[model samples]
Target: MIAQLARKIRYIADPAFDTRDGYGGKLVIALRDGTFIERTEPYHWGSPELPISAHDIYDKFEANTAASHLVGNVGKIISMIAALEDVGRVGDIVELCRREQD
Candidate 1:
């Protein structure tokens, strides 16, 4: 699977991206219609100026864990984390994340 995927992937360097202050990048998706979807990102994100919303954070978590055995605990974990100051023990969160024994 990896070998087949590697053959179709191409890596290239573009002089446009600069890293004086931080890493910069441009993402372009080439479509068959001779058009490209492009986005210019000046640098890495998640700073105070580029804060990630709580909704986006939960969406990412849900997308990654949708197929895992721990799917049942996602809701509870998010709730506990949101009100972390009221949580008596961090162990409660850890227990919900325990891996199923193979």
Candidate 2:
């Protein structure tokens, strides 16, 4: 999948390709075998009735924090936020989010 994504990016980056006016909320892909797939709904899991799971949210949080490397206490932050209802004070979580000195 990663390789395929890289290939697609390369194809898009090619100067010969026409990429103007590419903005769109829908995705339509046409295969070489004369088949195509399309999706019009922008947020599949963003609806209130179909909210994202805690695990999925955590996965996204972890990915963002890891990529940015801006947070030193990710685990503590995740735990604090997960149990925010039981937490005595929100400052405790804020304190844990402080960046560590090198």
Candidate 3:
């Protein structure tokens, strides 16, 4: 099930995510060639159930110098995906994979 979710979110491959660390905070999700799609906490999230938007999550990644060049890539990728949302490929892949999820 996790694998299916991960694959479905592969459109945002290997992007870093912003997370609150004990001391300060950390830019998480580096190794995997995919985006992080975890639910946000109620305290930090506006909706509790669906606080974070896909685009907001993408924006949290740390910019260039160390990791991938995330300076402007976030918006660029989001725009790219937005343009494709009405298309069939992403939906088809997600629907097909979701059928196998258990």
Candidate 4:
């Protein structure tokens, strides 16, 4: 339920701005068979939902009209997650998720 709501929120918020790729740029996905695949590129980032919470409470709607804005630094966030993965650091990942909740 939360994921569905978040996807609707994201689509309504930014129809043009897709989710991030694993490494850097936003992910462009193929929706089929109730599954999505990342259409990768040379500078691909991770799939969108992978980096964010199952629910995106980001105030995208309110921020849309602002002249200047700051996007959540997802690449850095993913890097931290990757570092945790590389070191077999599950506890750190949990802590990171907790911080994100705050």
lDDT of each: 0.81, 0.67, 0.45, 0.43
Using lDDT as the measure, the top candidate is 1
Stretches of model 1 off by over 4 angstroms after superposition = 1-6, 13-20, 30-37
Candidate 4, residues 1-102: lDDT per residue as tens digits? 989856753322333334342343344454556776654333332255344442242334225423422224443335655465574656654454443432
Candidate topping TM-score: 1
Expressed as tens digits, the lDDT of each residue in 19-100 for candidate 2 is 3423224555778898979765433464563578998898888888895544567887898899999899999887776666
Cα-based lDDT at residue 58, candidate 3: 45
Better of 1 and 2 by lDDT: 1
Task: For model 2, give the 10-residue run with minimal summed lDDT.
Answer: 10-19
Against the true structure, what is each candidate's TM-score? 0.72, 0.56, 0.26, 0.22
Query: What is residue 42's positional error in candidate 2, in angstroms?
Result: 5.9
Alpha carbon lDDT at 69, candidate 3: 41
Any residue pairs clashing in model 3, and if so which? 14-34
Q: Which stretches in model 4 have alpha-carbon errors above 4 Å? A: 1-73, 83-85, 99-102
C-alpha positional error of residue 39 in candidate 1 after TM-score superposition, expressed in Å: 2.5
Q: What is the lDDT of residue 38 in candidate 1?
A: 87
